[model samples]
Target: MAKLFYVLGASGAGKDSIMNMVREQLRDPLMVAHRYITRPVSSGNENHIELSEQEFDFRINRGLFAMHWQANGYRYGISNEVCDWLAQGLDVMVNGSRAYLPTAKARFGDQLQVVWIFVTPEILQQRLQCRGRESAQEIAQRLERAIAYDSVRPADAIVIDNSGSLQSSTEQFLTQMENTVQGQKIKVAMDSPC
Candidate 1:
């Protein structure tokens, strides 16, 4: 059985970078579900789809997105390719919202492994500043929501503190992922119909 590891974190917790790094290091088959978004392509990031608000709305009506959300006045979503990879027994890495975990778990069953990446508020603020895409007001709002998320429970999750360097955090992520994959296999087996 394969695992669908859904990585969740605050907006600036380095979830995207860590996922990319882990993918490069993984010897196993791994698929990254590219998120569809309405924001312009940020400099140095070229992998995402830059959809217009109208196009995003059309797709949402068409049920094209597996999961979608509106944040910072932009829309974002995960495509059905995520499930496609898991169906083929390949590991999947996705940067998703903790708010979406229940829906994913209900849909994917035990195959969903939610990993929450953690970072200090100070680090997150610095990253957001370095990105230079959001305004000070917007950054403050996002940080508030991030703090709120910290108080909520992420269902069936592994929390990885990422305040350190990327290398150290990647090592911790891989270590936790190894354990998560093994546990996911048991879940798949149990859920399999006799």
Candidate 2:
């Protein structure tokens, strides 16, 4: 069966950069799911579909989203199209929310694989400062939150330390995916009847 690789991390953990690199280099059946968000496209580096608050409500009422959550004063959603992809036996990856992991895991069950991308606090602090998007106080708060989140990360999550070069992080992510695919193939082969 296909799996959903749920990628999540704190701000400045390089999730976007590493995922973008993986998207460019991956040659497998895994498809990355784009999120629909209430935030404007220009506000961040993520390539999400922007939706008005009213539009988001309409979709929610229509059951168009497979999963949805609110964070940082905005709503984010993953379309039901991801379900279609999984049904078609294509593995899917979604940039996910740390707070929404429980709901996602409940929905996807055994098919969900959590991938936590992280960096050392020192590196994360430097990255946040360099981004210049937050005030000093806000950055400090973020760093504290990141540390707290790291402490309670899911026990089964595949953790990637992304404090070094992007290339190294990308390679680690790719290796994880390759291993998962291979393991699935092995299980399928073993389950088939002679």
Candidate 3:
């Protein structure tokens, strides 16, 4: 059995970067689920499969997505193929949406772990600004949304402050993730009939 880790964070919280770093460092078997996004990939970061809105909806209708959500005006989804990796006993990490935790929990039960990465408003603002993806007004709106998310955070989630260096944040995240998985049984429906 493999653990499922859902990484949630604001736009500039470096969620993707932290996951990438951990993936590279871990000697144990692990998999990071690449998201299906309705946006064109850029050199910026975050590995994802691109799709049009029509194509995205088509997949959703066909039950191809295990989980999906719309945020920041984009559609994001976790592909059903992730179950295969998990079935192989590979720990899975994904850039997950906080809004979709309920669905994830319902599907995977105790196998699901939430890792919330966060940054200070000042750092978040700076990082988002550097991405140049949105206007000043849009950035402010995202910052406000982050604050709102904090107030409703899940009681069992492991939170990490990403307001520092990439190395520091990545290390902190990995430590917390290991702690969460220690001695806990995480299954991926490996024994089920397809």
Candidate 4:
């Protein structure tokens, strides 16, 4: 069975860059799901499908999203096409919200694998400053929240410390995915009727 690798991280933890690198190098049966966001498309690094508020509502009404959540003053969703990929035995990765993780776990059950990207406080501060998307005050607030979330992150999550080189982080991310795929194979074999 394929798994849903739901990745969670703080804003400046470099999740997008790491995921992009993984996508380029990954040769496994895995697919990355682009999120549908109500925010307009910007020159930002996040690779997401932008939608108007009305369009977002229309999709919600039509049951087009497999999972949806509101955060940071915007609505984000994963399309139902993810279900199709999983049904076809493809591992799917989604850039996921920390708050919505419980719902995802409840929905995906044993098939959900949580990947938590971690970064040091100093590195996070520098990245946020360089991005110039948030004011210093806002960046401070985000750091506080990141620290609190780090304290309570799920015990079962696979942590990838991305404070160093992107290449190293990419290697770690790929290793975890490979481990998950191998473990899934073992589980399937053990569960098969003799």
Candidate 5:
């Protein structure tokens, strides 16, 4: 069966960056799912549907989204294309908000593997500001929302700390994916004492 690798993180937690790294290292038979969105496409970011609220709701109610969520005033979705890939036994990775995990699990069961990309609030603020997308106030709001969501995590998940160098984080993520894909069980390591 196809493995659904669900990547989760707070806003500005560098989930996109980690996914990009994984993509570069992966070969054929592995792929990333492009999520649909009701927001306008930002240059050089993604392919998405720029629809109005009414149209988004219409399609959503029609059961078009395989999985969907509302975040930062935008509605995002994964389509049947993803389900098709999952049925093909491909390793499909999807980066999404925490709100969609339950629905994904209900649909995919044990085939779903959740990875939480964690970043500190200080790092998140810096990254968000550096991106120059949202205002400082908006970044603060996202941080608040992320904190609330963190408490209710998925039942099965692997936590990837991203507070350090990119190289280390990428390697860690790749190692986890390798183990998961090969059915090699591993335990989470504790942090070193300060």
Candidate 6:
């Protein structure tokens, strides 16, 4: 049996950056599950299967997704096709939603390994602004949403702080993935002080 590594974070928490690095370093025997999103595919980011709202809902109604949720005015989904890969004993990772943890956990059980990537509010604001995808008010709203989602972070998650250098955070994320793939206890110093 393989683990389902669920990567969770705030809107600007750099989940994609870490994941992209992980992909470059770890090729075979690991998979990063791409999402089916209602958002138009952005340049130089995760390649998602983009669909219109109507098409997304049609697929959902057809039971094509293993898990799905709406956030920030977009619908995201992981296709049921991944279940076939899981059964092949391949470790799979997903850029996941915090709101959908309970549902994902129920599906994967002990195979679910939560990796929570976090950043300070100041860093998050700066990153969000740099992305040029949102206005000041929209950025504020995303930060507020982050505060609410933080409370839902799983107790046993391997936490990583992505507030500083991307290289450092990506290395930490790689170690986490390596351990998971080898069935070793994930070793990492907690990013949080509390």
Best by TM-score: 4
lDDT (CA) per prediction: 0.80, 0.87, 0.83, 0.88, 0.77, 0.83
Q: For model 1, what is the alpha-carbon lDDT of residue 171?
A: 91
119-175 per-residue lDDT for model 4 (tens digits): 999999999999998888999998998998887688878899999999999999999
Give the worst 10-residue stretch by lDDT in candidate 6: 185-194
Which 10 consecutive positions of candidate 2 have the poorest summed lDDT? 185-194
Which of candidates 4 and 5 reaches a greater TM-score?
A: 4
- Better candidate by TM-score, 1 or 4: 4
**Residue-wise C-alpha lDDT for candidate 2, range 1-194, written one tens digit per residue:** 78789999998999888889999999986688999999999877999999999999999999999999997779999999888888877888899989898899888876788999999999999999998888999899988888887876888787898989999999999998888877777565221110
User: How accurate locally is residue 108 in candidate 4, as Cα lDDT from 0 to 100?
Assistant: 79
Per-residue lDDT of candidate 5, residues 33-76 (tens digit):
88777777773255455777887788788987778888778888
| C-alpha positional error of residue 149 in candidate 3 after TM-score superposition, expressed in Å | 0.2
The model with the greatest lDDT is: 4
Model 1: ten consecutive residues of lowest lDDT: 185-194
What shift in Å separates residue 64 of candidate 5 from its native position after superposition? 2.6
Clashing pairs in 1: none
Cα-based TM-score, every candidate: 0.89, 0.93, 0.91, 0.94, 0.85, 0.89
Candidate 6's TM-score reads 0.89
lDDT per residue as tens, model 3, 1-194: 56788888888889988888989987777888899999898735878899999999999999998889999889999898778777776778989887787888788776677889999989999999999988999999999998888886788888888888889888887787777666565433434111
Model with the higher lDDT, candidate 2 or 5 = 2
Q: Tell me model 1's lDDT, rounded to 2 decimals.
A: 0.80
Better of 3 and 4 by TM-score: 4
Q: What is candidate 1's CA lDDT for residue 127? A: 90
Output the lDDT of residue 53, model 6.
93
Pairs that collide in candidate 3 are none
